[model samples]
Target: MSNMEDEYDFSHPERGVAVIINNEAFSTPGQEESDDRAGSSHDAEALDTMFSGLGFEVHRYDNLTSSAMVETLTAIADMEIHSKSDCFACAILSHGGDDVIPDNTPGAVLLERQDYVLGVDSGVVLVASMISIFSDTRCPGLEGKPRLFFFQACRGTNMDPGVGVKVRKTKVNPDVGPPREGDGAEQTDHKDAEEGNVDIEDSNVETNYDSDIDNTDSIPLRPVLSVSPSNINKDILVMYATPPGFYAWRRDTGAWFTQSLRTILTPYNATYWSLTTLLTHVNKRVAVWYESSYPGDTSMNEKKQVPCITHMLTKDVYFRPKNMKHSTLV
Candidate 1:
């Protein structure tokens, strides 16, 4: 076998590619502009720098509609680069909503499109369902390769009420309810207007249902390969900025969780830390920062948040600097 097939070395500049889907403004067709993710650009810049420092080629897409995001991922899954690479990574920054689609169908709470009620991006694409696009069969070159996904978005409408303390209280944001679409859809539908546009280019299709949704009333007699997570998500690692049903906190500079991620993955830190250990550190640090907040009367004290990670990695992973030679999974 060639050296490429024998071992995986992330230090090599061509060993992998990382894509960043940075959605700053969520202005879908016929919808008023959604709330601007004030500091997302900084978050994107930090991610680009962090990945580049680790020696991976980076591709960034901005202001994409749902269709564009899907097209981009589909195209990447078909790229020749994976055959020559050790791994792949994708980072998505957007607003998240509940699983209420236009047809009252349940979908992932990620990505918004026009007409708040309708699912776009060729239909409603759930966050959990995004992985199938890079299945071992669909993207053969990526089989057995690490696919890391980082998400910085809200998973639900609930906000952290923050623990009560003896300290003086600050003015809290009045419960304005969740964001919403212009047509008086539920507040949760507002989430559909953010991220990229849903069906700007692929506007012809009205309801692109997520593949996970089963329309049949009868059970299938034959077993499907992608039905189970273990079978299809072999070498994947997903890290969310916040736990399910929570809002991911971001400041003027960037997201506290991702910023902490940058610190833990840095060369100086990774030499001694494993990927599992690094994520633990990120979670703890983020929680502590949120709890601290602004001291004194104006403080939103005891607000707690935790990062969540799901992995199916068979071996341990330790990130190494570009110039350093380190252990690779067997």
Candidate 2:
């Protein structure tokens, strides 16, 4: 692991960019708010503060429609500034679900919604399509740079039924424990991140300008081959608020996952821990936070959640601020 860390350059690139797509209110005009997402803004603000403290230039988009989200991402992908940057961090905070799509024929298969996070304008946009625009094949400037994605949304409707434990309240220490060190190499799909964006469709937004072409007219077909390995987007990290097929817990103050993240990434803590170690701590903290808010239903009272992370990074990652020592304690 030490040898692996020695192989890469950790010099600060020109300027890193952090993009925050924050969706707070999810209702359009004439419709009641389907979801208020009470604490998303808190998450976004924390993320912005953290990334900015790490020297990233933050770009935030709030309450965007699905089409608007696509347009925004597309515009970012088309920008030529990535080469001048060292890394990119994207945080998406919104209402998400795996809504079922009914087949046209009866008794046919019901399809699960893929790659979309719900937009405020009641539109569903393909998250894959949006991110693919930044793929190495499409956006060459970002090649080899570390890309980070943080998603704070429910992956599904299923809730965890936590096992009963003896009730005992103790006076716990207010300070965080000393950070731990661990070596586990591998990256997550961020592909799931691509599949989680959902929004509504607007027929009025679609328009076509076309003319018939001659039958004799032929365009040469070219076959393109990919050199990269399958299911891998190298040098990227994806952190989800919850695992697939689970609900992400939240409070009026903010989401449990984001709060845990902020706590772990504090300057004092980050100086002593690697990103992987910090994330593991976050997962544990979130998993142990059992919710008991049901008024009369004990079955619904015990709920738990854990965060999911996918990374393709081949080197150690640290989040120390500028002028801080790069030598990691791990």
Candidate 3:
């Protein structure tokens, strides 16, 4: 593996991006529904803090039309299919189903299958494909930059209660550990500081203290565990609002996770934290705020909503701009 620090670049054309899609309205059968702009304004300010000077030009747009969704993505992807450019990051806020959004446009822009996966993912392959267009043509000054996506919408129509809190990391007792050296470890995902990511392995990274023997397959399948080769997009990271089979909370007037996300990014100037560290703080802030908002709501106290971060960064990311010195990672 290449050393993460060695991947740094002094000149980045675009610092990075935080595309916030506040879908506050939807078109339905000749009818239109407006979402809360108050929440949108709140979330936009939050995302802007994270995007500003992160390594790309910060662009902001209101809820897009159904037709505009695909078209907009196509147009932007064309800008940097490949080259040593700044990274890509986006935040989507909308009423969601399985994998589609009801943009305020005429026809609801349905998403592709690959985009349905967890963590700031959605029609991302299409965006990645667009990046390939530039790379294939050997586009000058725009290749190898990471593409990060942050999605804050429900994956499916269904909504079930989610596990909102964790007293601590769950673990198995050593007394119950299985005894055997060849048993190997189970497949798992783990985080590393240098790479600023949580990587998946063919074998689980977590330990089952109850089992004395590791249960993982000794044979390495780098190809299987790594992000599919079919996806050439490199250094990508996605941070999602919640997990499957759960409700990503939103108030009639405010977006729960989004509001907190902005709180962390905008104030105190925290741009130096890595992707993992950012999410870790995000998870904490979101959970704490949710708990406080509904003081009387019992279920709220029990459940903790965390941002599901899917990271694939090359080098460490700071909580604040590397060039600028900030006392606190806001």
Candidate 4:
């Protein structure tokens, strides 16, 4: 067998592909954009450090639109790993509103088109689901393999009252409006790759549905795969940043939820621990860390968001590689 295929762990193998998406560029995307965009660089850095330590072959993409993300994810899923690889993992860092985020550039695209409500690349979930489908029939051995997705973006609209602790990444941003059609190009041309670069005005954005939607129906955009998480056999372990109708905390240090995942998966793969065990560690760490440090922050304190494990998986999984290198997170 080829070396690449030989590396894929269908049963108990070595190495895994780690896809990390960093939506916020800090200075590039800027702070004034949204509450979640702030400190995203820190989250990305943490993921990079953790995953690198664990010996994962990490691939990264940043500031992508719903369509661009679809292309990237499709390419990843289309890849044919060897019969030996056990699983795959992905980390998404972005400003998510009900499973989707506006295209990061926020230039001329405008809010209407920007509100694609995508989960896969918007924050984390959408990408995970796309990856999971590949393991379904295309990869017979991966039928029951583990697919881990870690999300650092907020899941709700509530804001954290985290105070006193100064985060360095937060900065000033100007309110920008969505660019008019053909603002950057010709007026006759409507939708094209160039139109993808339009400016968006999200400050005046409105919600078309209920505010307290559950994660099960969290995804906003119409996805290509219609299967619910309950039906899939591929084990998908989703570590959400917060509970339904609750906002996940992003500290000056970093996002509380993703940081916890990083801690659990760092230095080496969590091969010894099952999906449940790893999430347990994540749940405890984020809750404790935020409450203790922030102290008296009623909004964020005491918010111990549980890791929502949708049972599509048929087997146990450890996020990182087993014996190849030190444990890490991403």
Candidate 1 — which pairs collide?
A: 65-197, 66-121, 66-197, 112-192, 113-198, 121-198, 123-208
Compose the digit string of candidate 2's lDDT tens values, residues 1-330: 243354224455555778899888765567553456666787788777777766778999999988888888878877777877767778777776444444457786644344347677656655445556667887787887777777787666566775444333421122244534521111111111121111214322211212211010001122222121113378877787876556676655567777667655665555455667778887875665424244355554445677888888877665555565455434
The local distance difference test score of each candidate is 0.57, 0.60, 0.44, 0.48
Q: Candidate 3 lDDT, tens digit per residue, 1-330?
A: 123454444245346444566555443354354333334455566567556625446667776654465555556655642244555667766544332223355684542222232111222223244334334244443445555677666543323334333334233111111233532231111112111122224434321112111110011111111112123444566666765434465543345566555544431223333445556676765543332123354444223355556655677554335454333323
- What tens digits encode model 1's per-residue C-alpha lDDT throughout 20-101? 8877664457756435566778778888877786667899887566677778889988999887777888888766533422
> In lDDT terms, how accurate is model 3?
0.44
Among the numbered candidates, top lDDT falls to 2
The TM-score that candidate 4 achieves is 0.57
Ranking by lDDT: 2, 1, 4, 3
List TM-scores for all candidates, in order.
0.64, 0.71, 0.56, 0.57
Which parts of model 4 are misplaced by more than 4 Å?
Answer: 1-13, 25-36, 99-135, 138-141, 158-233, 268-271, 292-307, 319-330
- Model 4 lDDT-worst window of ten: 186-195
The number of the candidate with the highest TM-score is 2
